[model samples]
Target: MIMFEDLFQSTTSVSLLVVLVLLVLQFFYSSFSSKQQREPPGPKPFPLLGNLFQLDLKRLDICLLNLSKTHGSVFTIYLGPKKVVVLAGYKTVKQALVSHAEEFGERDITPLFHDINKGNGILFTNGDRWKEMRRFALSTLRDFGMGKSLTEERIIEECHHLIKSFEQNEGKAFNNSQTLTYAASNIISGIMFGRRFEYTDPVFQAMVERDRELIHLMGSASAQIYNMLPWLGPFIKNWKTMMKNIKENNEELKCIIADLKESLNPEMCRCFIDAFLMHKLKLEESEIKDSQYHEENLVNSVMNLFAAGTDTTANTLQWSLLYMAKYPHVQDQVQEELIRVIGSRQVRVEDRKYLPYTDAAIHEAQRFANIVPVISSHRMSQDVIFQGYFIKKGTSVFVLLSSVLYDESEWESPHTFNPSHFLDKEGRFIRRDAFLPFSAGRRVCLGESLARMELFLFFTSLLQRFRFTAPPGVTEDELDLTPVPGLIFSPPPHELCAVSRH
Candidate 1:
């Protein structure tokens, strides 16, 4: 038998130990629950699956817009463990991308970007490396006549070639997509290699097809899957096939670079590759860090220029033609302006100033088409307190450029195709703050000037020589403005007739 005092002490100790364990468990449970609740107010997430069920994975843009209605401009969505905060509307996107530019300056280097870019290319690199590559690209482009007389000459020559090709169709309706692609690709190829490939060249065709495939993969369900699950992407059957195509394209690009290296002449260096190679040699001599000037960066940068420069300009031109065909009155006005300014002679880039109405029409086409609806994905550089919400480092953000361009408050007739949006009461071409077809901030399209020149020169030249019309049985209403899913948005398949005005 135990004493009564000893028995009471034992009971007290036992009760205290039990209470402490219960308190500790409660604290742990609360901490975990708080973490689970930490995500910004969003649709309820299921265990492991999260909000995947709520999302329409195929129609990403539509799904995002729908979510924005319920969650406001800035809201969080989950792709498994990843939390992406999408910024919608003009004000929210512009504030994050422009006002707080540096804080949200990093690119979300996904699995595919990592594979193709290797983090060395300007588009993918961050911090010091990005600055260095950007500076180099700018300097090189300037040297290569990006905004100079030489570039104008190249564009004029390409415009003539394009006209000839259209004339070959002899008013017979043909898909202008391929012809435009060839012309645009040649412009970048001329800049990169100092030579242009014939549209019929097997190698060139292969490269173009590969580029098209890669771009198609971007923003596709397969691409999202790859980004969400990098480790499993290679093993996934469909992703594996897409990746193989990408790898083949990369290999082909490398082979082209190899050929360029073999053909390099120290005495008479030509083109971007030659200039880059020469620069590399100088850097080697000076013992400078050659990270940005690597052969891989060169190939990737050239590929980037080719992909970006070609597809975007081509698609925009195609859309312009479509609109011109649909609105003959607008086309007639543009043609009159072209005739008044430049006459039957080849259209000059300088004529843009005198052709205000024509310029306005071009602007309208871009606005109406609205390619690149969302700006490229950007990641936060560090923790930022934005609109009372703490956006942690590495959070994915987007600038909804399309929303801004088509914003009802900013645009008079946001839904309509109106050239008056860019025209003043005096009938002069006026630039709008909301007009950002080439994007803005540090990551603005590097080839903006080149693209602008091409669009103006090509459009004016074509208008001066021909009248684009709908193919015989196709009505204006039949023209589709629906865009195919890709990194660079493009119109669905359509064809038009180019009647000679000569």
Candidate 2:
């Protein structure tokens, strides 16, 4: 009893010491920050907590929107010791992400993710390396038919498999998360490793679960707090487990790399991995020492490609499915359009031009889903004064994509999920400048083209085949549109009955 009591006392003392150290560091940080040029206006943050306590970590979108009301479109907020300039709304987010693309193009590695990613990969890297990797990835994916018939054929193939899975459910209520993710992951799997996994493959199953956990864990309130107060990491909930998950995911990617390494042929590259390995070999022959095409980069790039391609595309489709179920009228309109345009024939990407309503509905779904509200942090490469505020070089910037999606000044019914947001009076599909779901400029989403293709093909094919409705006794009114909190704004856990419309 005495030993246990002593251990508890020791723990308490060490925790207090950590707090003291953080407080002192924060004090120095604030003092140093204050002495810099005039920063953007924002609410006063606390000694060490900063604006963390005031913000709702889960629904940070709402919190940021409210703060923008008081702090103007462009304002600063401290996420722990980190100072971030948030660009809110259409005009503000556009100005920062598009107009000042070069200055606001670099990504900042947060403490929570820094250990996991280690400043490698296309998503996290910056400067010339980022440009090189980004260029290669774009070209490779394009060559594989990112927005063309090759990719379209892959989507059509996956849709058949996915539709079969839903059919096996026999119109009963079923949670589609696992199957949906598998289908999405397989698309990237084919692109990355040259083959898709069986839906029942245990390895693929584990990969999906790992990706979901890592994304949710990183975006959790606990992770955010840990990034600010690294001293309190051990005490944070599931910190060790999250780290384990990250390591396991990386290991799995490494294994995939190892398997590919055995049979790589430079002239006949199978997929992204083979292409990268070929590049590395050429670099070696040229004596290009310390090239970014090494194993660390290869593995990280693969992970980034898989994660981004799977989650964003899958989650957006999931939400769109829910919206269709919730608004049967919209779903009916889509089916009618599909049936009218291409009766009994498989829906093609080319059909999208003729199906204006269906296209608008999909766009509105992307806008309303707002999968990523606060985007990954971006850094200013060089100091610049803009909008009467002085932001220093390397100052982290956060773009409120949610603000842009639901900007009152832009959308007529910003808060509601209305397809007219993407349709003009003549009923033609119109692209809004404020609709920056994939964001804008150099740091825009790497898989934007592919994601758009998947969303359209997967969505159209499904609705053309199935009549989505709420489960058993559930009514449309009973359906919840509020998302489950995490890195992506996923729809709540609820089953939907995919009644066959065929």
Candidate 3:
């Protein structure tokens, strides 16, 4: 009986000890939670999940806007264990990106970008490498006819092909995305390889498909997960697969670069690649620092140009057509302006000067679409104080460009699709400081001039030849201006008929 009593007592003692240890662990966890939960006044976060539960990935922009209203312009949210500071509203974003430009000059690569860019490409690189690439690219683009006659001529030829494709559509309801894609891709092709691909070319189609797939992958939950937990990539296997696909695309680009190099006549440099090769040769001859002009950098730069230039311009064109279909009055005004300027003949870049109203409408379309919803990530090179906050060195920052473009303070009708935003009292085109579709600062888009030219010429030419309208039962209000959720915001799929105005 005494032994039984002792055993019971011992078991009771062990149970008490276990409970005590659990209580201590709870206390520590509570302390850690207090530290993490102190993140700048946001909506209540779940214990382990943070605010991820509150977010709807499909309607990300709307969700962010709502959160911003509640949390104010600058607030912190957690994606897994990392603290992400979201800057909403134009004032806050401007202060971070423009007012404190030097402090926020670097880019945060994230695990996925790091894997894809390999820390070598200009978009991903920092410090000396970025400076070197930026200088080279600017010079190369200038030499290759950016804002020059040669570039404008190439654009004119591409615009003619696009017009032909539209004519072939026979005034039927069709998705103009493919035609726009063909035209935009060809522009990049001309710049990169000194050649243009036919719309029906299989190889060109493959490249576009690959690019689209990669872009689509960027916004996937898998991408976010991989970025937060990079160590889990090999174990997950799917991340590896995605990486492999990206590598294959890079390899394909390299092969094209190689072929171009083999066929190049050093005496007559025609394209961007030729110019780069010449510059590289000169560097080697002078025995200067040769890290900047490597073959990989050249190929990646060409790839960057294609990737950045193609989809953005194509997407904007698609949106412009949709808007025209939705608002016939606006379309008529644009067409009238074009007719007044060019009179149903081939339009040139020079003709934009005469078509002020048409130009304003084009600018307004870009403003309404606001394709690049968020600015690219930038990082602080050193510890800097921004608006009383001690932003640490190496901290990643982003400017919510959508906030600026759609700022109520800046635009009279921030939400509406109004061309009056770009027109003065005299009905002449006027530029606005807030109209930063290509973004601003040192890392502003390299293809800005080319993009503007394409948008103007293509839009004017299309309006001159056709009047876009939605098919039966489709209302103007039914047109979806809501952008697809991604790193780059694209309009959701829709179709419109291009009735012949010629």
Candidate 4:
């Protein structure tokens, strides 16, 4: 009977200890719950996956925008394990990016940006490195003729080549991909290498193709899946090819930079490379071990320039063509304006003032195309309590640009292709504060000025010479304005007949 009593007592003590432990855990969990309730509201996340299953892999921007309707302008969403605070609409995004620029100044180095950049270039770097590199690049680009007559001349020259390339198609339909991409690249190439490649250059063509592939991969469903399910990489081996292509391109660009170095003259400053080399040589004596003006930066900067300078302008130009083909009346009106204003003076940048209708059309095209769907996520440099919600330091913030670009409140015809968005009652060109195609704030596009010049010149010049029309058997209605998404949303691939307007 004593033995039986001891067994019961021991079992009772074990059960009591278990109950106490549960009580303690419940207390801590409740405290944790109380704290989290203070954080920005979001859809309930599941264990491990967080909100990964909730987000649409393909239409991420749309998903977030829709979520904003329910959760308000500021809300948290788990992008895999990472907690991302999405800021929607013009007021919210602008306030965070422009008004509170310093607070939201850092770039989020996600696994994708992490693998691609590996802590190099002005695009991904932060702190002093980013500042120094950006300053140098801006100064250097200006010196090499961004927003100036010299730069305008280069673009005009490229326009002539692009026109000739179109003329070669003999008014028949052919994809503008090769011609437009190559021509757009030459504008930047003229700065980076002091020369341009032929339209048929196989090596340069491959590079552009590889670059496109990478952009698509990063924006692909597979890439997002990899982000959430990285452990399954062995099963999805196709992604490895994307990585391989990146490595190969990097090496090729390095070789190009190395060759540029061999012929670089500090005194003359022939191109961006020459100018960088001169600065690099000067830096050889300085003991600043963390200097931004090194070979890695120089190479990555050029790569960034190529990626931004080439792809963006080219893709937008492609969008321009697609829109023009889709809306022939709009195209005709733009062509008429070009003929009336420019009249064959090589369509100089100075002519922009006299060509308000043409200018308005171009601006409308950029807005309607809206290639930059999502702005790069910015990071918090320090813990910030914005809009009565706490955001920890180093957290990623996605500025949903589509919310602003396509906002019903800001644009009179946000969804439709309407040039009058930038025109008054007089059909005179006017700039809208909401027309933030290049974005705003301190991190405004590095190539904004240059891109503007290129778009105007490339677009107007093409329209000035060629009356682009849908090929036979294809109706204007058939030419869709729907953008096939990429790093930038590219227009669906289709061809237009570039009939010479002689």
- What are the lDDT figures for the candidates, one per model? 0.79, 0.85, 0.76, 0.81
| Model 3, span 384-431: residue lDDT tens | 655545555765565667877888888999998899999899998899
Candidate topping TM-score: 2
For 336-386, candidate 4 gives per-residue lDDT tens digits of 887777787688888888888888888988888888877745888887888
TM for candidate 3 is 0.89
Task: Please tell me which predicted candidate would have the highest lDDT against the true structure.
Answer: 2
Give the Cα error of residue 195 in candidate 2, in Å: 0.2
Q: Model 1 over residues 1-502: C-alpha lDDT tens digits?
A: 1123543467666875675566456545533654743444566655444567888665666677777789888887766545677777777777877888888778888777887677766777788877877788788887888888888899899888899999999998999998898888888888888888888898888888777777767767767766765644645565665667667767887887788889889998678888888888888888986456788778767777778778888889999998999898899899988887778887777777888999999998988888887654788888788876777788777666777778777899998889999999999999988887777677778999988888888888888888999999998888787888667778888889999986
Instruction: Give the better candidate number (2 or 4) by TM-score.
Output: 2
lDDT per residue (tens digit) for residues 1-502 in model 2: 0123443577777876777797769667765776676778898887666787888877888888899999899888877667888889889778777788888888887777677778777888887778888889999999888998999999899999999998999989999878889999999999999999989999889888888888887778877776766655666665776778778988998888889989887668899998899999999999998688888888888888898889888898999999999998998888888888888788888888999999999999999999999885789988878787888888888888999998899999998889988888998999888989999987988788899899999998888889999987899999998788888879989899999876
Q: In terms of lDDT, which candidate is stronger, 1 or 3?
A: 1
Error of 1 at 218 (Å): 1.1
By TM-score, how accurate is candidate 1? 0.89
Clashing pairs in 2: none
Considering only N, C-alpha and C atoms within 3 Å, which residue pairs clash in candidate 4? none
**Full ranking by lDDT:** 2, 4, 1, 3
